[model samples]
Target: MSTAPPRRAPLFRRVAAALAVLTLPVAGLVAVAGPAEAAASATATYTKVSDWGTGFEGKWTVKNTGTTTLNSWAVEWDYPAGTAVTSAWDATVTSSGTHWTGKNVGWNGTLAPGATISFGFNGTGSGAPSGCKVNGGSCDGGTTPTDNPPSAPGTPTASGVTDTSLTLNWAAATDDKGIKNYDVFRGGAKIATVTGTSYADSGLTKGTTYSYTVVARDTIDQTGPASGALSVTTTGGTNPTDNPPSAPGTPTGSGITETAITVSWAAATDDKGVKNYDLYRGGAKIATVTGTSYTDTGLTKATPYQYHVVARDTADQTGAASAQATLTTAGVTDPPPGGAVKLGYFTNWGVYGRNYHVKNLVTSGSAAKITHINYAFGNVQGGACTIGDAYADYDKAYTADQSVDGVADTWDQPLRGNFNQLRKLKKQYPNIKILWSFGGWTWSGGFGQAAANPTAFANSCYNLVEDPRWADVFDGIDLDWEYPNACGLSCDTSGAASFKNLMQAVRAKFGANNLVTAAISADGSNGGKLDLADYAGAAPYTDFYNVMTYDFFGAWDAKGPTAPHSPLTSYSGIPIAGFNSEAAITKLKGKGIPGSKLNLGIGFYGRGWTGVTQATPGGTATGPAAGTYEQGIEDYKVLKNTCPSTGTIAGTAYAKCGSNWWSYDTPATIASKMTWTKQQGLRGAFFWEFSGDTTNGELANAIHTGLQ
Candidate 1:
């Protein structure tokens, strides 16, 4: 599936929640209405907090000054012709032309006498909010009522409980002035203070009972009464009342490297029994394991880190932390040519079904972050490289709106379709290199015949890719033969040396000026697909190899055990051995391939199954899940909302919603993978295609930022 275009379909994701008519302080901006002469019983005020010339955040605060309660309030304002609201939270925001309105959401609507509420929004253009009104009245709240302490916050509700951590959520409290923050208490003792309604508490004992309460504090620092207590008991540990295990000995460092730190220590003793050891970097828990040894990877070179360990008993109670040890990494790995290569595939067929055109790369903000683009499936038919879709490649006309440069493609134009658009994209981002990829799952069968005469095949590809009409559209050629001497949609028996010969000939034909790459199988099992060809020998001929690390498991198995299709590491009950990114990378590295010549493949989409019994892995499923474009396959954009992640394993996230179970990489998981890529000194990362990411290129941005 990773090698084909059939699975990709149209999908989108939304980042939701927010409108308060929040107002900023009018103190310095204008003369305040003195408290000696009050006007209205209640009022709202608008303030433009910060402006970046291009956009600004506006807020409106509504206050109740009278003895009566205010049920609801709405803040309305207008902007100039070029200004508009982009998005809002804490309320519903709508607009009529240049006029904008915000109303409080269900939970934060009511305001007690002498209490206040607020809403805010992000807007485009530099124009400030004007003609502001609150509930059909002037936004200025002239009256200044006597200040009173805020009411107690709603009782805290706990969820996502684990042996070491739990999540707490509560409703906001009412205050005369805006609420500044809430102090979280455990058994009447203050633990942490935060401004948000939720907090995730960690480093707790398992099987132990705890009581939590929240106290609200207003802007003037007046604290409210504590909310009612909510009792919680973490799962695990034999007895909560048992004494904690003794602290482990100071860690002994060994096997030190630039990107990894391996530490071991004597095990700690417990009265009941030792459960797990908690590893900490500063105050954050990095890992938990029952063993006495741990190796932390993805560390920066020439940097010092302080680490300590705590022992937890069967009751989940932890002992005092061991003495910290500071270790500095040795040296940094050399980055690949042109830094980390952030490449993504762009399929010709996408413009046909998914409506994902080349312009999406620019609009989604992906083009600015990426280093390369692989225009896929140029075709390998009749032992000669040919255009996959002539219309999509150079014949299809594009309208001005759909064009990358906002220029229409005419019938008389010399070049059209994706090729012309790519040319325009290159002109816009002159730094990005474009490679024409030939042979996919459907066209891979032709590679066998093409491999029969490597030189002839190389010659055919060179002539096609360098065709003057569209040669400037591509800087190089890429071979995605699926498997040189193994099976994909079909089987190939061109021998192990066939791939090496073809690649060498292609390099010879293209010479030193052009780039050459290939997408290879990632079956890392002993004597698996990787061994069927001379991948190591062919390594020199390629600018880099795209290890198709996904699709190791999917609905192809049908009626069966569910597994993460793109797990970065091996986990317990992994359905198959060596079917993961770790195994593939290790295997390739063991084959003498340099990490700089390897680009880890990431699937922007997800593979899932329906009729699943559990949210966790290793569960039985009836069949492939229903997807927008194809069964069993869905884009990350849709899966993120359709089935929110329930848990994670082996460095990837999985979710189960209703009867369907899905596995996909989130921005967080992608960051983790990018860290691993750095630890392994890999060249960088490339995703399967562009359409699966969010509108802002969330996943792609994760890679770009994580590598730094």
Candidate 2:
């Protein structure tokens, strides 16, 4: 808590003493220790080795090595020449220039030979130290860098239309004595000398592969090994004929009273082989046919129905869905009230789902106004035979029941372990519902395929969403195709009604009471590409439309004046994108999307910019800000402390210190938004997620209270 920097000793002197007596011999060790020739009886282990930037200040974990329980001990080490000791912890350490001394001073507990301990200190470094050891094992050397060498560069292992450029990742190196900067090289030629480890190898020739490597140098001109060579191939230029089949189809037309309806599709031909088809209905995916022809059975006696299928390959990359086809089943009457609502969080890929939880969301009052929870993704592994784009790149290790699971996966499990938690939450809060949202920013690539055969896509989704293994876990489905008939992550050629066809099939299969919804694009910059998608056409079949109004101005636009993430109205000089929520609403309303069926998006967290000297929203930003996910955005919890200035924008209490600025919605801002949602006659207001609120429910409480 103290503002003053802790004091310490000279660099060179401290290093000498510390390294000199780092190791000690116990009385028992001299007695029957195994292998007299060995350097010591046993070596101590350090597991949690982390570098907080650099210097002796970093923390280290230590393990006991000797047979006797350690009642006391000492640890010492010399830092690189330019480094100096600033502070010490977990024990007392005396410093002398480059050398440092530490010894146990407090309580003495039995440190069983194999037991571990942790300690840390704060120090400054200059030159790179030759050797760093813990219990005598050489760890990464202490660095006091002077000059930095360029990092290796290269491309990706594979490329495609969706992923055209290869991204190069490199290891970061620091110099001792004093670091100047870093340089990055591509194919032996300097490309860029960045301060970080990641670089996007853009403007690459599609399908052309490239290899790269990197090395780091310090101020003293000491060079490290050139990183191992890595290779990447750019996604070949757009080749419809050569590309694999599209995403599976979704079903439509569930409420009509008809005995039967025609089912047809645009024959799916792939550059590779088309193995067979998998049909889905009633939330179950069944392998219905081996060839293209499939006659759906078990129709109700005069009830509307829907169906979808997935084309598979030897590698199992399921092609896009055929246009969703709707049929009438016999014997059904009396439709339920309005359709159900699919509520939940939409998160990034690679991150875990347990990261989304009730604890992360609010449901107590206005915030709890949500009737459903939707999880954004499940993987569809890519290759020659790729499922939907989003599904392919998803984390497969996130099994349906591994709550808090944080691993990768090849295929999506029916129910993310988080779904079970959601299932339980529904039981506790029966008024709420749950849905599976597929195809987001990354997953949208598959929607084109889904548009081809809406019925088949719907069926595939039904099977996964309603997998009996987790029966009754979800209430319905939510289609988050970035854009329907229009362009989003990529282009969809199936025409405008492609979305209508898919939703219709899903509606038929889900019956009258199930939930069906879609997140319409908010790109109102031009002729309303979202409106052109004919959301109104799908409204008749969907329960509600989620208007994604956030992410208008992002790090993607390198230009300045970092603005609010979700602005209510467009201010002067605002970039020409649909950066405000109001623009999306007005556009949707103009397109005839009923106000009662439109849900406005509210960001739980705030987007921000750094290097801005100004204090207002439209103020010129000098550079980008640091974020938990994106560099310029900050989560609410983090913003609460680092950028309290965020609370006072527009009478909001947010603030910013240094270059960190945030745009979080406080209880008051939430109240204003709720009032606006009512004035606009919007169906409701939705937050990006349930997380980012205070523990006592301040933000959520405001929303609930304001909504009333």
Candidate 3:
């Protein structure tokens, strides 16, 4: 697979652009104000918006009531000794010692007789300021503003009542100045201020009656009277003698595959509602979920597994485990005549600085496990396929130790590089087929030209792959077109059917017996790459499609709220809704492509960010993290020891150590994903270049064992 910058959602792109222009100061300054010099002519009011542990946001409204039209105005306040303003919006602020002055900006410098202007600021203190002044005059009481308070909010209704939690919803409040927020009160104490009409209250005492009220506040700090009170009684609390939920009905298993089983049970009755169910495998707890069904994956082929379910209620009480159900997974079935295709890419450049040669595959045991190898990547030049690097492909000399068969290359040899080593490996493993892949991310720029005259392009590729010098080294060809009608490293404007036409020409030239495959985009977002081309029309001409499913998110975005690179499911705070492995598979299946013709793609490396302070996935980062080959990326072999996984989320593992945070898949997560692949009925899974894995090929072992 080729690497590209991370793509952003359309809505998030606009937000990110806006944030780039909203820079503010990090340190606060202090300024002192002169003593009051004139009689009070205007009034100013201050309101606190929100307050975190170390910072606070505040707003101020300055109103003119006197008949005189003021040409300019400024507001001053005295802060505590250690407090200071950090940033101000819609106004220019300066400070001296404990005194702060806020001057009007260009747009709101002049004030009419009855006009008011509002400005806000972020500060580094908890306490509100005092000794306020406007235009160097006392602002306490000379003029009364004409703004009216909003009307009281309507009564609230409560539902989903539990022993310790309930939800409250109310009608929206209306105001001339626009309602900004509503303050929720419980037992005469302010509980929360929110912009929405509904709120969930949790952690309440059981069997207790609670009184609630709400008050509407407008943008100018005008608050209306509180609404009428309403009371709700919670359900009774748990008792020492309370009985547990009944044993779940006998569990049943279905959708059994070589490595997975789906188990479900009938709902169990309880004094309180059932909170969740625990699933056990071989007498060990494997998973806990709120639903009645769960898929147990990553098991051995033809292995017998025992499963049981136990239901629990809101009181943390679990019932007796149901009778165990046993199932033996079926063995993998081979294709009728041509065997399942377990293909992986072998980059020509891996023989350079990476120091990975064809010999590594033999030593690491990956060659015996895979069925086919793709030599990537040849390039497309002048509307024809050509060699990307002549030296790497056929001219570089390898020593006896570097060669696959322990034979040194002679300077006069016609073929001497990776092309020759691959030929030697194929001789040892006769079943392993090799295909020459062309048009990677960087070289795909010429595809638009090739699509213009596909017959000529196919002729060029056919003659090159079947050249007499290396005719015995290759079986067929594979097209790694980054995209056809959508954007990748560059943009393509050919019609939607251009890709299908090109694939047809290649199949016609290569014949049916020789394998012809293509790697296509798996973007499932609405109007994404999948919709830009006619993939279904091209599927019939190719043996199978490699669905590139990983790299959904990464640090190519520089500053980001970090997220997993390849999430299998949608979590609570996922950045994009449709950018997951499941969504892509469902989309292709919906597009009339059979599940058995698709092969899932996985990344052998991990992506991450730097300058992260929080351990969770959503924390803000400064930029891309440091790496050996590139920033924001590292091999799984290095990350497995550098930043070990601390927890799992969204079907992936994440780790946070000191100021660095990273996310990657572990052996256990890969096992779970393999189960999902079998459930989806996909042909198999493939990864990128082989050099990223450990010397022992730990990740390769996991993929081989999980697929079995």
Candidate 4:
């Protein structure tokens, strides 16, 4: 099914490494709100809690726990006595008296929720101060001796019982440091300190009522308050009680006929161990097996049974029931939703600013019908946190008569670097429509500011995107708001309506023929991250929502098996946050986003974790792995050579070589995935960048053939 495009000579090659020249869409500056640009710093979150000359530099964790994300934010912490402003990186620090404030310096400030930002300064202090907190939470002032916190009362359950004795059980109590034993008090008098959860009160008069309470002590000998009293009286051995026997072990139901269920388990032991196991249908005991196992015959098909084991002594005394396990005798239903959705890449031809060359895809037979092609960025000005060189960054790049070089070399050449070349390429390729994208991972931080003055921001973006200089270059505008109504860098707190307003303004500016789209958050583990973005609220105004589903697993999780880069079913042993791209898509659909309006994501390059020793897939990768551009990770181009063997499961590719491993998409894997995409009734797919694919189009080939 895959098709490779014919090879052609290289065109529009730039000296600099491939950097997408995203453009801001506007003209003459107009009055708006606050300073367009915030001071830039690589690390954006800044908070000051201490003053200088206090002798202690303030150290804290800047947590993005709120729903709103922060692209860039500043924190001002006052220093303690004798603590002077010393050095800083990725931040600009200013000190006045005991007050010290550090602002985000350049294009850095990015703090996402559940993500912590930490920065510290050294100070001349004799020892740790008694008072130190982070974001108002208690902090470890310094590495010092500490005592454990008191444990909470555990859940008490009944256990062994006979005519003469009654036993009590409870859950284990945990302590910060360590738990000493638990004190079991009989009638308020200290009886014993047991290391475990069981206590037997024996040889007491059958009619005597015994009250028991437990308290957990720490390694520091600090005792917690006693648990609530639980009183029990042993019954005389004359009455016949309805004590059920223990449930059999390993109870398994298989080869189930419509009218019967064969339930099997290990033999029940007594010693009170298990006398027998009872099988219940809807909380009512249906059968009890005195032997090892039992078959509940004449059972209706599709019935559900709950089973439990209760051990009984020879005296007919019964122990507490074991945990309940469920069994369903039913017919299998139709197959679940098809595999991961497939996305397609739509880019301007091999031209200036739209540098994503289709040649790599075409030659590799990857001419897949992409649902959408998003043109790089649209500029915004007169909005909150607009970069200072806004207009000049693009104006300077435009040359004589509309024959333009797409970008300028540096910020110094203000009024340079626009997407004019992309306009020509779009004109030549009429079949593929390009949507002008405004804001992305880097520029998304300004959205809060844009929300404050939606009209001005919209006008500016509209002017640039619709400018006649590059008429017909774009079909519509795509809003790549990394996150809205929630945290990305700092937070907006501008309210959820801010996103809807921004989209409305954009829709008004671009008109109907133009596509209005947005890139939504892909963090679906808890559903909190994606829910905060409010994609459903903005869906009515958008043409499609691009789910950025990659970047789920990266070097961040080094020293582990590559999580299913794209998983189908949830599996244990995988971290809670672990989810495949399909999960996110399903969530969107469940949240009311139409499948046709959803565009899936594909990573052109693979994300890797290195320093591995195992050759097989799903094995641990030792760290710290080094990334192609940074640390602890590598890209697909580099990874193919370093670790070539791939693991094929659930239709995706992953590799583990020694202590290093990587999760990536090969030509074969992509093809298999595309089949599921068609079956799922999804719109299409999109990739992060175009340059990361194979030169001969192998990966693209799979996409093309599979989607076809």
Candidate 5:
């Protein structure tokens, strides 16, 4: 999945540890010089926010307690052996082995007397740093910064009343220092401290009177005055004779993808207000929602699914099930005159240690869901396309269990390995097309040479792909040239028009019905990889462009402020702007590529980090996380059970457990992405490779279901 060179330690250290001080005079103010000792004096406070086994997050605050204004400052600390700072914010951080130094950024360098600045970092290994010093002075037993308490919060109001919950909102309080958080109290007992003016109190008893109040607090832990209390009685109560809501009206299903379906029904009546509706599929309860509609996801393609709904009351009473609604989802249907396309990639090397043979596709049920699979990766050399591995592609023999047709390969057979197995798979699932992909990140070095003789290169590819020995195994050719005139594993100076020229040559030789396609860079940054080629001109010669929308960030940035590899939307504080699915789709369409000719990319695996101290994203890490195949990367099958998603950000799933943090898409997130794809008018979706999925193809199922 990563096209970049194998990761190593970063060459440049952005942070360094030193106990030096540099002072500069303030521009529009008269000098008030102080003694050297007094000017160098400062206070530092360290706080541990979270600790998860091998990693922890810590915050450091420095206050200028000297009489004269301090022009600049630096903080140094000795990290425990085996520990390292992976990321830092609000300061320039650098590390030398176990020692870390943080210097004030330009904006926070100058501090007047009594002024404080705070910065945080993520680190690896257990325990806290020791021997901390601020501006060459001991940080231990330093003076604590002081601040005044905030003003009293305003009276609270309750709304959206329910038997078990109510919403509370109050006016914000003021503070000389910033209001850090607000504490909410129920019946004289503190419940929570929130940063906003509102809180939702849930799990209450019906018909019970409850009183609520709020108090404000400043960053220095100063609690302010409490707001006037307000009391409210819940609207409903448990009653033996209370009637449950009637069964929901006959449910109707629509918007069917290969793996998901949206069902909606009319609301039912209830003596007590209806609390929620329960949805069932295949005689099993799937979900309960407060809305009239629900999308049942993670389904198998081409399968018949029956669904119904029932209503419930505040008393936890349920009604009868409504009439069943049945629907057969779209499967590996042939591409219609003009419709969505679902494509996936199959790697030849997976047959080895991963034990993912071609038969696994059929056994895992992925073959029936996918309309096309690209066989990766044939090599590029001598300015021509060629088979990457003769044994893996067509020479190695397959056992009966490993073969798609349950037949053993003969020693003297003309074709044996993955190619023959693919031929059999196509026979079984006739609608599933196959393409031979050449020149991935590792093998893209030859594209520059290939561009020099497009016609000759296309001729070579045609001969190999259309070879009489295994001609029917492939339906077309997919160019995975990494980049045209930009840098990947290697740089190319083939010029901006090179890619369009190459695609035009291939299309002219291969013809239109043969399905010419390419996987192109989705870097949405201005003047990025998309600007390095003439993709718009090449679009006319290709069936579609597979937009690699994932891998925007990862542990590849070893000293990382970790982020999701594939984020759907741009969230606040995203490391890079426009490096998201929305931005890619918009930019591609803006570049004159039709939405229907673009396919979104989803990663079947996840990118992660180790020695992660924070439970949420934006935390720093010591280095790449440990994985079975490669550090910093793991298959979804392992993470879904070992880590499990705890929360979501930017439309992707992330988890934190012990010292590791991982981000990948869950079934629910995939469904949402599929909806977005349709809304954007994109053709469909595809994942990197098939072998990373579960034995039953859980992530693959999610992709199929969400696309519908």
Candidate 6:
């Protein structure tokens, strides 16, 4: 293995080059698929144009790829039992039961070399087309997968038990096409359809025991085998809501000491004067006081505690509980468990030319595989956080066919666009946590201003992410400060503590429940980006870090020797020292950051150039290779078929053809890297964006499988 030429500049302008617009939401889900793939001669590819609640629009592109003319092309596929083509346009579409066929129009049949034509049809039912054939050949220019249901979900775990409510969580199942949602059953009776890994079952009888199991359904609504049962017994007591005075306000703490603190809160308003306020440390009642304050003693020093209050009226009814307040005694708290965090970024702007959407997560089966989504990006400017794109965030209208819930957005709705759809997505996949990511390659220029007033920046972000209109859409916030005390799209000279201080401020505002994370740099050279900031010091304030381990090399250099942008290790003739993912992890770990707190980053696209003279790395080239979405950068979906892997180097795949070369991670390479990720005891793996994978999310699925 060998490296390529030196960097023109040690900067990765990925988003800036990939997207020129200044638009994205505070948070949203996004994904993409190639318009068409290759075939033996004339090829056809399918894409779901728009999905209304009741039906959707489907399109197919037929292209002549055999260096000859194609006179008339026919595409055929099978829809599930209830799904059918309702109408056709620019083509004659006909169906025999569930088997459908479409032929090019009389005037549009002929396609010369590199030429193409498209036809679309209105469809009912939610099933995607399968077994696609272009002019009697496989549509993928390879093997068409056999249709099969997903495997059974893992056995569930019961937690958060209460008299009337309890939560059930389980691992997700796997499928080739992708899992859509999970169906939970109680005592063999179907109870719920949820898109996430957990379910909170409520409205139950006290002292009752129930058996729960989960079954997964694929994108086509095919139910798989059910998980083993998990029996949960509700606590034996009156429902918390049945008893009450009004709920108390958030409790405040003062006179904090190593061993104790004075906790006070606003009193609950009750028609019957409040009899008492019951204070709790964690979930247990610690004290019953008639007044609004209590001095809790006997706490360990340098430990963290959570407190809440409930009110009881003269009739002894238990009022609702106040919001939980978290406090650390004497010192900062340690980071939590190092569980795996499989995260991905969802760009709000991808819905435009990419035509990706939140519903695509369900349709493409990605939502089932990912544990979290970092919606990129909100903006950081004027020393505070701000909306990246208002229209995309909460103002745009969506038709029922294009909406996540299959319900049309009303003009008078308080919120629409991605925010509304995200809220609906959470309702279906409650287990998939979302973070409002602020700043990226382009927007990060404002971090210098934000670093000057970290507290103000933190507060602004809190207010926006928690805004009532779409508050339910996000679980927390993610800082994508490209660099601190270093150069990125811009430069920052804030002291080393600036990064830690900003993270501390955000943690203070977001509290313990909500995730507070950041996309940190992975530069590992001496005195590089990692050395310029106090990431290790900030670990205490972060749930985990999404280490940006990609972009070590790319067409950013314009001309010269090609190399894998995201190399796993160093090799001969390397352009720079300590510029690989392994070096970054080693450096961070040496600095005392736990491996569990780090997630390895994977790129969903490739960066390359043309005019290459050799088939291997280190070959000189003229400039960047042509790309569909952006020059020098191409989505993996497109490259997988067009440039197919010609070789492997430094734990990644690369291709070379007729002076053209590109580097990207295939499902095979991704699986291998995931293996390395686990061996390193790292948290998990993540990718740049979702829309770069196949419609069925093969790359995302590979990550899911590798982690398992």
Candidate 2 local lDDT, 581-606, one digit each (tens): 77677656544455677777766676
What is the clash tally of candidate 2? 133
Residue-by-residue lDDT tens digits, candidate 3, 1-708: 111111111111101000001111111112223353322246676755444335555667676665555556788878877777765555677789999998875546565567776666656654446667677664344222333456778888899999999999888788765888888989866788899888899999887789998887776655665777889988985575777898897788889887778989998888778899998764457899999999887764544566789999888888988887766567853331344456778888676556788999999898888878889888898999998667778988999998889999999998988899999999999998899989876577799999999999999999999998898999999898877877654567787999999999999999987788888887877557777788878988988888877778776455567888777877888887777787777667545565677887767777788889988888888766766554566788899999999888878888887777788887788788777777666777777757778888777777777777
Candidate 6 C-alpha error for residue 330, in Å:
30
TM-score of 1: 0.55
Global CA lDDT computed for model 4: 0.52
Best by lDDT: 1
* C-alpha TM-score for every candidate: 0.55, 0.48, 0.55, 0.49, 0.55, 0.54
Which runs of model 1 end up more than 4 angstroms from their true locations?
Answer: 1-332
What is the Cα-based lDDT of residue 148 in candidate 5? 38
Stretches of candidate 5 off by over 4 Å are: 1-338
Local accuracy by lDDT, each model: 0.77, 0.52, 0.73, 0.52, 0.76, 0.76
Local accuracy of candidate 6 as per-residue lDDT tens digits, 1-708: 001000112244321110001110111111112354323365565655443345555567666666545566777788889877755555677678889988765446666667766665556675656777766664443323244557889999999998899999999999888888998889865678899999999999776789998888776555555788898889985454444588898988898987787999998987757999999764457799999999988764544466789999886777789997866556433332555677888877666557788888888888989899998878887988888767677777998888878999988989988888888988888889999999886577788888889889889999999999878888999998888877665557677899999999999999998999999898877558887788978998998898888888876455656898889888887777888898788777655566677899998898888889889898887666766644467799999989999999889999997788999999999999998888766778888889889999999999999888
The 10-residue segment with the lowest total lDDT in model 1: 10-19
Better of 1 and 4 by TM-score: 1
TM-score of 6: 0.54
For residues 1-708, write the lDDT of model 4, one tens digit per residue. Answer: 000011110110001110111111111111223355322211122222222222323333354444444554455444456545443333455567766565443323454444544544334432222222222333323332234234645745556766788788977777776776787878855577787888877777774467887777666554554667888777774235544345346466766775566766655544434445565533345676676456766543433445555555565565555555555555532221333223344432222222443333333444343334565544333472232222322433443333322322453542233344444444444455666666664356578888887777777777766666555556777776656765443334566678888888877776777777777776665435565555666777877777776665554344556565554435554444526666666556544555666666666666556666665445565433444323433446567787774576545577766656666777776666666556555566666555566555555555656766
Alpha carbon deviation, residue 266, candidate 1 (Å): 29
Q: lDDT, candidate 4, residue 542?
A: 79
lDDT per residue (tens digit) for residues 613-653 in model 1: 87789989876776665557788999888888888888888
Question: Which parts of model 2 are misplaced by more than 4 Å?
Answer: 1-343, 346-369, 379-416, 485-487, 646-655
Distance (Å) between predicted and true CA of 418, model 2?
Answer: 1.9
